[model samples]
Target: MAACQTEKEEINFPKTDLSNMPMIPKPLKTIPTGSAFGLDAGTAIYTSTTDPAFEKVGRFLSENIKSKTGLELGVNSSSEAKLERLIYINQSDSVDLETPESYQLYIKKDSILLNAKTAAGAFRGIQTLQQLIPTKSNDTLTDHPLWVIPSGKITDAPKYGYRSSMLDVARHFFTVDEVKKYIDALAYYKFNTLHLHLSDDQGWRIEIKSWPKLTEVGGASEVGGGEGGFYTQEEYKDIVAYAADRHITVVPEIDMPGHTNSASLSYPFLHYAGAETPRVRTDMKVGYSSFDAQKDTVYSFLDDVIGEIAAISPGPYFHIGGDESHVTKKSDYILFVEKVEKIVQKHNKRMVGWDEIAQADIDSKSIVQLWNSADNALKAADNGSKLIVSPAKKAYLDMKYDSISEFGLHWAGYIPVDVGYNWDPETYVEGISKENILGIEAPLWSETISNGTELEYLAFPRIIGYAELGWSPSDHLDWEDYKVRLAAQVPYLEAMQINYYPSKLVDWNKE
Candidate 1:
């Protein structure tokens, strides 16, 4: 194995300026305190509150420290940590906080205090804390010794409330462990949402007890005619719980009307009579199969499927993919979306669909994700529906890095690292301003990629840039300065064993 591939292998610690540590999604404010804190075996972590969530945050920090350095720090459930060197996690009762994910980190010579209004805030702050600890230590203890963190104060919060990363598990089924691994990477960058595209033409990736055949038959085949898999309710819940622990919400998507070949194949009644007998689609072609919008049985089937999925999904939104219905008549397509939106709401989940859903009379409370058309986005804004901006050219992670890229499609055009990082979400679309937006999401449609290595290659570096756009202030964005900080993130990526693309845009800190 290459030396850089192993986390324990010693590497040169870059001569970084402490004040400007390479932190992604740069904090809202950072001020150097001209001091440093030494974290050693004697250090203990104390929590101000008895809440289990707060305690979990404390454990998370200690566990990460133990993993990176051979130091097993103690965690104590106490209100105070006196004289002895310690790290404190506190939940504040302040009402002046910007958002639920906001937190303040104060590092002094003797102690470190992380304060936040909620446990989620504390969890987010812990990410910053992890970033502060250098990948390599100073002493000759195999480059892993007592860690020193530069003293500083950081007041941080995401500019947008709904930063998300969408994974298309339908085209390619990712195992629960694989999904958890992706969630870990998202948490490291402080992303709060993981949108799982659960169903598509190629496969149905989630189980519905009422519709057993949905998984038994529809889930049997994937994009390349491989034996696909599905996640049982228990496994699906496991993913949700794991994400929640990391302060990330999992949003489930079940595409309908157009991307329903799998569903139609499972139950022919769901397929339109005019189309050929529904068959397993191993190709990437879309907009060919659709649900019979006129049938009352279709709505009943959807209600049962939506209810089963919604009961397990604690998140507030459910995605009914409303894009690419070329064969369905315009009127039928609009009516189908209107009915499905009601079904989503019947289960207490706000409807979220692709930009095409804007053509329907969707509820003002629903959300429209901008993927292709600006007119559709503007129409959504006009209807008072908030938007999740994921313009294909800028935020699509599955787009090829260049013409020679081995994996991914380029219909949306190649999204080089710099092109992906340079666009501003707040001003990307003219009609949809910040008020109409609910943050941004980078959708990775798994057409050419299958395993974790290919998935990580397309997601990293670019997705890192998306995380920054979602969290940091819009006016403060700078590609030049940001690239330097991004370069410093190489160690963390390597340590995590992520097969990330080494973009030439940044001078990586590989010393």
Candidate 2:
């Protein structure tokens, strides 16, 4: 055990003025060495009297240090009055030391304490620390680089609690390793939520113990194009663990009440009786096969499926996809809502559905992901449901960033990087208050994206812009400033060999 220091030391840094920016703080004089890894490798020392949330921070540091530094770390909590090399989270204080929504990192000699008023802030602080830790390439710096902690403190919290990015693994399945890489990328950008569209008309991407055919048969494809396979239960679990380690929640979406072609193909009864056995539709557009939401068997089957998925995902929300259920009889929509509500309540989980699902007489607790228009978000909020704004006109990343017709699906107008960066959700809905907005999401529907590289190409640059929109205050995000920051991020992405869409060349000097 390391001896604890018992004195308060006044800390000071050079007050040299650099950029006159009010927000940017002067760099700290000293930098802390060593790294904290995954959850199990503890770092922070606290008293048993420490808040549970503070303990959570310690667990996070331990886990993070092991994963990032490949070193095991331990935490010791004490009531002794001392100043040490580590950060000390003073839970006794009511004022928040760091922003709850964005990332923060603090460093001190011998010990460091990552403190946040809220659990989310603690999580974000750890994320920033992960970014600060030197990777293999950064280990050989010429000057002993100081871990300059950003000053002027941010009382930061998320603009939207549900800043999400949805990945369509059903269109073209990504391997577990590829999925883990994607999770890492999302974490880097401060996107806390990852929606895995695991099942669709094309294929079922998870194994079901009760229904082996769902994976054994539906996971395979007869059509050679867009033909990829499902992940085994073990692989899916590993992916979940990986995302958990990154503090990113994985919300598995099983398209139902529609988009059940794959599941229907596995079991004929899942669809309307005597309907033709569903097959993979090669057309990129959404297909119509849906589970008979009115059937008792349908509810039973879904309960089993959702139970399996919920067991693996630690997220509090589940996506019971209710989009484009063309075959859902008017009566079935009502019944579908009832059945979904029962399942969600039974599992102690919240449900999230596309805007159309709002039509069903569902509980207000279900989150509405407004995709078609801002009006949908307004309506959802008015109806007392939380909202995630992902309007097709502005936030949809699947749309091409340029006028190149060859790029995007082309239903909505092409939206380039600047267009994405320029979108203001606060202004999109005229009378609705921003308080109703739970957060923003940029969906990457994989109808056209067939491989990891294509997925990367379409996702980045645009995704970065979305992250800023989600994290930074709306007034703080400027197109010119964002472009500058974005340019710096390109080399980092390249160093990681990330495939991404190139931003259109712009002459910023003229502006």
Candidate 3:
């Protein structure tokens, strides 16, 4: 039997309308053509240029298509002739796009064209295209004769350049493969940044070669007193490379002053004199342990740590966890932050810290992440530092869906799916406007969750809406319309086997 019908053959496509297709973080503009594109074995993916960037995305599209529909679509880079039933990926020569991640997608009965100014843009466009593929035909094991994509034209770009998700690996170390899986989920939602909370009171998840004891002693235990783990330098690089291939930047964070029990346990010198000698902590309590802010050696130690991590990390920013220094005096805390800022600058990376860092005289190029304090956020804006808003009530993933939910905390109160999506970052704090904002980040602190399933349960559904909040324009967001779009994502999530919360607020679709 023939795998696909020829151009001369008559193949009737099902009537399709994409006017209200469930696309998270809806595109800036969409026009449904009331037609559809049918995929078969004969379709080929074509790259318009020889650039590896375009080729990479082309191959990615082909691979994803094959995985979903049991179709063998070959990627052709040398093709110059127009081809029927082809997916053409191109890098446009335009400098006027809103951001480097901007893209345009046009789909017709015979072909799909994707145009972007950069590879990141092409990657995002492909994600939107993936959403257009009907879930009924998305089976890899079974031989599916046909797959369909709704015909449409979409022009899209993110409202914020830094749509990020933070994974806290310090409290409970997640393996590289586990982290990569998290990265895949982030990329599928068009998130561009993965902020790794690498160190905290419970554990240290990255190896420091100069100070072997840091990981040897500090990384040995986790929140439940279980034998924890750490990633070697080579392993860290591999994770970074994997994320880069998906167009996501890896932002490494090492919390300091406070959240230093794991570090101080490895070296006694880090603790203040006459203070209780820090021991390994498995409990969830915070703001107890702190680095010796009065010591010059503490600054010298940070120089080596920052230099080593920055050398391997290619990203432009370094996050120093500057929150929760309850034990340290306010004056000393401010001085510690100021000195650490210089050390971070010396490593050629812009400094990033929690909102408390605003108390220090830091550089304007630095970024302040707002987690619990709006006053600190306002202070950061006053100091001219950019802010990444992750308000606890709205963006904290570890917050339980409700009192009955399993595997999450309730200190920040229950953050149901709707609550996570209904807030605005630009005006969340009065003094912090659009100009002083970098973007929004949903931080998944791993205090309660231990494995991938638990992580997915807490992150999905809500994270999907967070992605929309970060990408879609503020004026265009409507809760009623978005819940429907989010409900449409049920099939994709089910197909991917993501263990998402079945929130009662959304009337999810059945597969």
* Best candidate, TM-score: 3
TM-score: which is higher, 2 or 3?
A: 3
Query: lDDT at 129 for candidate 3?
Result: 90
True lDDT of residue 315, candidate 2 = 86
Output the better candidate (1/3) by TM-score. Answer: 3
| Per-residue C-alpha lDDT of model 3 across residues 101-158, encoded as one tens digit per residue | 9998989877889989889999999999988876556334224466778888898989
Q: Global CA lDDT of candidate 3, please?
A: 0.87
What lDDT is reached at residue 321 by model 1?
93
Best by lDDT: 1
Cα-based lDDT for every prediction: 0.88, 0.67, 0.87
Q: Against the hidden reference, what TM-scores do the models get? A: 0.94, 0.79, 0.95
Residue 314 of model 3 has an lDDT of 96
**Model 1: clashing residue pairs?**
none
* Candidate 1 C-alpha error for residue 128, in Å: 0.4
